[model samples]
Target: MDPADSHTDEIALSAEEFDAVRAALARVTSTGGGAQAHSLLAQWSALVDEVEEGYSWCAPELDNDLSCRNALAKVWPLLPSRVRAIRQPELDCIDVRYRRATIPWPDRPEEGARWWTWRVPRRLDVEAAERRDPDWPLGWEMMPFPRPASVEVVTWQYVPIRPSTKRM
Candidate 1:
């Protein structure tokens, strides 16, 4: 079902609960998150999804915006602390640099044959050559387009796509 179309019950929470969740997100974002920290972050993110299911904290009367969900969406993928997003024209997408990694950074040689490269949704696969940081957002993982096994797929599928009730 389209998330925008589903009408869920209001998420009930007190100020304290809100504060706790916010603090947890902040803590997870600011420190070297251990396994326990990652676990807490997962739960906290889920709470954000639940709380904003049918309501937005940014504007209470606003049915047009899902502010709470949007905030979590922005933060969840690119945890503010562990990764630095650098947009690279080479990859045609943002190359995420992890903290405490090598200094020379991504060792990929800038000079490469253009025909040998490809972009799968975002960054070129070559840019993600190193070991992935455990904390990197799931969405950051770029996969090969047109799987060798199934060469028939054509268009990309999207989620929560805007409905065409009013017509484009």
Candidate 2:
């Protein structure tokens, strides 16, 4: 394990990673186990019964999805088994789903809108994709899960250029 992979009591990660890691840690500590996420990493002892190593909370994106993938990997080790963190890049948000909801989350990028739509993962009981509210930021979404199961979307507002790769 990279020492960098070892998170400490000091919250040293980038803001996005820190927010994500903390939120995930909240889930683990809340589970029946008498655990506390004093550090982003629960002791390896605490994870003995968890899913295999190199696990992450989000669905793995493709090799070329750079920025978010880098941040996601850093938070992966801290996640409890069964909570999935999903990325909706176009909307500049992340969606978290705990195992309690076992449906297929949305995989499609939203379409035909002036602003990006923030879609509740289909797997979730929440509403479908809709235009983002003013509070949604540019590049982050935090879901606390179970209690107030909902997404808080943060994104950088912009219109990205869609370069056509095919020869016209």
Candidate 3:
């Protein structure tokens, strides 16, 4: 009996049937890799499409127009979280320089006593290099492109906030 026919009593394998089985296994592996690559490319393509669509309205001379800002904002939330992470540090560096430091509460004794001071950084520096490019989208400088694989997203959830009256 041929090796392929040894199990003929249970099942039979023809040349075409053997080839079909091989092809199915190959497809399964290919699909897995293909899906991942497709996902990554889709993300990249969407970002490029958004940038191109927003380009005409992004001239530096058009900075004062609200339409330019609104168009860019439409795509802002759809950006992948990863992209945002990559862009944040660069934005932070630029923001720190342009921000004006002011005491949050300078008057009203009670308000001043309870004031929770925090640095309110500028949204974006209009005078900066990135903002000066006419071809650049108005808020592109603040774009949150995710960092490379070195970074990961973390989430923390906790109970509701309740004010503590006890002074430490």
Q: Which stretches of candidate 3 lie above 4 Å from their native place?
A: 1-74, 101-168
Decide which is better by TM-score, 2 or 3: 3
Q: Better model by TM-score, 1 or 2?
A: 1
TM-score of each candidate structure, all chains considered together: 0.20, 0.19, 0.20
Q: For candidate 2, lDDT tens digit of each residue in 48-124?
A: 11212221223222112222233334445664432222222211221211121122224534433211122232221
| Per-residue lDDT over 72-104 for candidate 3, one digit per residue giving the tens place of the 0 to 100 score | 233334444443344334333322322222122
**Candidate 1: Cα lDDT at 95:** 19
Lowest lDDT sum, 10 consecutive residues, model 3, at 113-122
lDDT of 3: 0.31
Q: How many pairs of residues collide in model 1? A: 0
**Tens-place lDDT digits, model 1, residues 1-168:** 432223222333456644544554565444332222234323433433433232112112221222332333334444433221211121121111111111111333433432112211111121223324432223323332222221111222235677688856
